[model samples]
Target chain A: MGDIDIANDTVSADVVAKFDLPAYLHSQQAIVASHLESALEPRYPERLFESMWYSLSSDGKRLRPILCLAGCSLSGGDPELAIPTACALEMLHVASLIHDDLPAMDDDDYRRGKPANHKVFGEGIALLAGDALLAYALEFILLNTRQVPAERLLRVMHTLINRVGISGLVGGQAVDIECEGREDIDLETVEFIHTRKTGSLIDAAMVTGATLAGADDDTIARLSRYARKVGVAFQIVDDVLDVIGTRQELGKTPNKDEKSRKATYPRLFGVDGSMQRARELVDSAKKEIAPFGQPAVPLLAMAEFVCTRTS
Target chain B: MGDIDIANDTVSADVVAKFDLPAYLHSQQAIVASHLESALEPRYPERLFESMWYSLSSDGKRLRPILCLAGCSLSGGDPELAIPTACALEMLHVASLIHDDLPAMDDDDYRRGKPANHKVFGEGIALLAGDALLAYALEFILLNTRQVPAERLLRVMHTLINRVGISGLVGGQAVDIECEGREDIDLETVEFIHTRKTGSLIDAAMVTGATLAGADDDTIARLSRYARKVGVAFQIVDDVLDVIGTRQELGKTPNKDEKSRKATYPRLFGVDGSMQRARELVDSAKKEIAPFGQPAVPLLAMAEFVCTRTS
Candidate 1:
């Protein structure tokens, strides 16, 4: 409470002028990347270690982790205290990616410009490594998060459970997989995937950050709306990017959703229409968090950035 | 501490005589099955619900769940209190089996006398359903388990983490998968898979039950040893049954391990020798729990059953 003051939400004029999202994201990603290295120790069964680390260590935007830290910072929580949980979120992300990219799933050959984990570690190790990461991510939070109250951790677990379990990410992924080659998929079906699959985790990231900081219910609710809207916007933009962004820009294979005949925003709405929808969502998300004023700067900028950003 | 007394450890002579393990297991399995029917209420997207429940509802000996209940009973804890965690353990086991039988993993077409989840549900749904179960199992414990303290629940999660993560079940499964099709696979490799893969869950089951019931450290350690020994013995007997029992008897494919060239105790030790080793393990495990006297009878009987029992 001492850390969070109305004054803290008001930025000095000079400080406001110097704020830069790319620079902020770069610093946040660095923090998350370094913390991630320590989060997963390479033990015996070197293959599991190597397989898990390969995708983890590979370069990515670190968006979810950054979002988590950003939310914590905005809530006036000690950002440092959120590192373990932040890393856990990233680890879970990597695990989902690893499994999603397996031969049986999306069957992608490349991720972040590297041969997919299974392409290098073999399918069995890749799949098991994903399983290990998913389970270990939860365990890491249980074992490593400190200063946060136990109930907060339980809230975090609850957040993760809803986001990761059948009601959320898994369900979204199932629908996405099920939608493959079905051209009749409506806006509801695409929204089904966008809102649940990728959206749940992003929404959880914000709630987790706010929860860790012990923010008021009002703040948490606002952030949830902000995150939910922004998450779907992010996915909508992702679909647009796949159609227009290059492999170098996306840092992986592009147009894969189209190639798989998977239902996507671009397929349903067209690129321009999807981009328009994204901007609308981001605008809505920004309004939701506007009450925080200066403290909301990063989240607002993140929403705006999600509108047209490549990769 | 108050519940555990000298008298609590004494088994009534008639209770010992009427133990009737098969009957006992039958009754316990019935309890588990009924609880499981409600453990996961099917929800739509209907495919995900269908895929998850297909394997979960399949008939098999509810060994781990029963072990958990038994441990709670031995400690004079309300057996009902252990049900949630027991169901969680079973859910996790089913998840492992679902992932294990995938085309990318074990490639099995049948499990528990029915088509494997992957075979029936498609690889993607089976995989996601497994992932859903794994995450949901943890959430279910947190959501259910009426009287357990938070710290105790945390302990249950901690047990699951160590037992099911990379160091335990998934790690063992990875090694087992890796060891497939290799002529030079050693006894140590076989032991590695046996102890870590199947053994970890069994070991955790007992510990979870004990932990839920507030068993002392000594009892937990002894139960762990008992479970470890019995798990390997169970696998050995399973391998023996695979070689000797018909499909009608085993209720699933038999001799599949030999077909895959996977190493087993029988391949390393002759059938007679494997049988002897299982007996020795059961004997040693029984000795480890010998101090518990009457309280250990069910576990003891379980050990002997693992020694020579066929499917």
Candidate 2:
């Protein structure tokens, strides 16, 4: 690839208007899926790998990884350089899902239109599978990522780990679990939970990609802000879907938030109000990356997709 | 510190004879403890941090981190340089223990003479705490490790993650769980479980330290072989203690392996036979690292400690 100065790289309005988001998503999803398949081949202690792959292979929107690649491409870096990190993001996301569906946690029996990991592999293996995936994600990134400077890769590893730890997803989930069935939860508390629980990984995905691509600090910061807005909007849409969508459309049990007495965006704001909020966030997310022009098309479209996804 | 070529560094018999193993262990343990204490400070989302710190602060041998430092020191590197990775090793070890004690896993109600994590913090929070610790261990290494080349740090990360994932602890745990009550489990299978479940992280600890210290490939290989033997011996000692040691001495339930019908060294061979095997392995471990002479005192002493410890 030619050394394109990403700071000054721009495309005409006609080129930006011609972008096809669905095609972009489809192609990126295919690339991510292929890599994910080979990223963790089943090995000895076959059952454990089986359990890990079960959740990993189940169909879901490969949003985080796709966003990671998009961030790399937007910064004029080779998208291939970000593929391993992208795969790592998906592994982490699936791992969180498996653990979240455990009996002591959300206790859901289904995920992505299939039996949950624990339901099929039993809780013990399911839990270990989740643990394996979490650890392996880092291993995969370190082993497979090529041509990237070691310093940048270390930064990527640091970002991903930070987002997964107490300051981010774990802390958010703890508060969410603690506040379940409590009527005292406020909008601020809900936002706190959503931002960390869901938003942290989403932000990490973009930031890691940009950092790996050697994007300037300002560009990384812009992408991070864009991710933060979209992440919140994504969670709001999920809450709304859980309240209104069917099991078929949602792929898991619907109305679970109500059943668990969990506080949500729709609980505080009406469904219409929640949708309006998501729309506003999506618009703001797009605005955050507007300076990147045509290169930002995939990210802007993803933000819209997050606001509108049924499952 | 003056630059000493580790390959040529040696001590006379008089100095080696005067080395106080107990004092070395005590000092190293104290150093590791202090670092671990500051490694994870309590933060907001008070309950989550509380749960994490509760298990982490619970007293244990701190053996893994000490071994890491010993490996670094043996290679003529500053022990301080290895401290962060050493603490990461301990964190990873503690995280595994927390998860292992869960109801869905080992169902243990006690650990280190106190209620197990799940017993005190509910299964959900305990699980999350384990997850947080696992993720934070990597984060701590990346953020705290200094003066090491980024390539070495990445290699350390790769080594740690590889051991924690399916090929190591998780895979071993899975097989152990699967073979819980099976009479068909053979000596080879038992060794497989013990080696990976207990040995993998032990191997990672030493390897990470040596790698960070820029140990030669041959030196790393010797240390690795030393760790493998010591790790197996360590687990055998643990199994023997479960059979004969009191709860006060073991700091947990005794004979729980018999209760669970988990295959173990003592179960296959009597306690006498198990102890003999451990002694043999410890001797072999010492032989592997004998070339390092006086610098190998700590590691050699630790192997002996592993074979002889009551708990």
Candidate 3:
């Protein structure tokens, strides 16, 4: 049976559990990762290609791209048609990570299980590689995606640009970098950084997928609200994990946020309070998707999974 | 008369001289510059906004964007309609300059008679500022542009991404950085670097204008040829300037390329030979546009202008 049919079935708990969200997410991740593998067949300067793919081939949670694909599937749109868009989201994420890990930015030496791109390729190549990925992400969608109408593609294009560009991703990153080592950062500053840097892409991914699936304005607005909650919750949990989580569990640096004096939710709110906020966000996010009913079952499960991943 | 009508005038050398190209270029530059001034209006963080505009408001020639507007006007399209696309080209160019001037890249201290972005801001803030400009360029076009058809806008978007992304700007930057201080680099390597790094944006600027004006494939191909020749000539002129040019003229460091052991045309061919070669490229570039007859006058003058510019 199709995944949707399995999603629709309210049979025994055993069948219901068989069609669990984790399995769905796993298959989606593999599909997106596999597509991402060939997404960058760069021309000259083999090192540029190497630096770009190094971080991309790592073992991070395919959260944003899967959310895009989930958004598409939930709208009864062809998920296959959304895969290139999915790949684009993942590529943009990698681009941001490559830049963020530079000695000038986050200054981390390790990402995933390997040395950071800058550590392996040097800082200059890493910076250029990040730029390449960012530019190629948009081009890949334009050249590779098929069976989607031009209007939908245009909407998707605008959505990605706003999310990753100045209005969203870059703006937040600037504020985060500026706020580093400052002890007097307020709640407003923390919220601004998290929403722009972390929340923008998540919101864009869901909205882009919904747009590609021919979603209306109301549906898109609801997904935007839902995505903001999920994104803020994700960042709060991330702050908590960085403070107390281990390398084996997080797969990268830990407690670095605290060391950097970054304005984080966990710092502003205590760990217990942060966890409470995440759960509350998850509940509200699920409520936003309530009108979608059964199709949103997986989406609701996603929020729950996000709220208490390792607790 | 419309700009194209004046372009078609060929009564006398005096009239041709009277209807000069500089006046047209000046007006176009003013419009593009004015639009670019308010192109970025960041909401929350003021520092980010300041860092972004610092490089943008400098006293550069504004060549690429003016070329875009000129191309649109030459095609009988509304120059006013091309302003947003023109602004985007300038923004992307500024983004490249910001990143390229970083300590890890060219490591230049000066740009446009002032300190480079990284020299003015810290390394981290400079990097983020560049990212902000790059992202904002795309967003600005998607958000602010009007009256252009969706297909044309899509075409313009694709062109910018390809020109600025891996296959173009970022790829060449990686190679240029890698080849620096290496004696084994050959003429082919120089061609690859200059064409991708410098020529890509020039080509994109011309193609974008013509595409916005709905020019035919034949016309676009001719403009592409024109752009390549002019781009190479510009790079050759740049190489000569670096060796024997001044801070007052170039507005940045001189002789740094030689210090880095860069593969420059003037280094391979003597300075006089490189100048001769530049004139030849300019001559051939003007010839490609000769088929357009009277409407190609400004373009021909532009080639002549490129061949001999002291300051």
Q: Which candidate number has the best DockQ?
A: 2
Per-residue alpha-carbon lDDT of candidate 1 for residues A153-179, written as tens digits (9 for 90 to 100): 887887987789898888998998888
- Whose lDDT is greatest here? 2
What fraction of native interface contacts does model 2 preserve? Answer: 0.93
What is candidate 2's CAPRI-style docking category based on DockQ?
high
Q: Which run of 10 residues does model 3 chain B get worst, by summed lDDT?
A: B1-10
Query: For all the predictions, what are the DockQ values?
Result: 0.77, 0.88, 0.76
Write down the TM-score of every candidate. 0.95, 0.96, 0.94
- C-alpha RMSD (angstroms) for model 1: 2.4
Q: In each prediction, how many residue pairs overlap at the backbone (N, C-alpha, C within less than 3 A)?
A: 0, 0, 0
- Across all models, the iRMS values in order are 1.1, 0.7, 1.1
Q: How many clashing pairs does model 1 include?
A: 0
Ten contiguous residues minimizing lDDT sum, candidate 2 chain B: B1-10
Ordered list by DockQ, greatest first:
2, 1, 3
Give the alpha carbon lDDT tens digit for every residue of A71-113 in model 3.
8877778888888888889889889998998988889887876
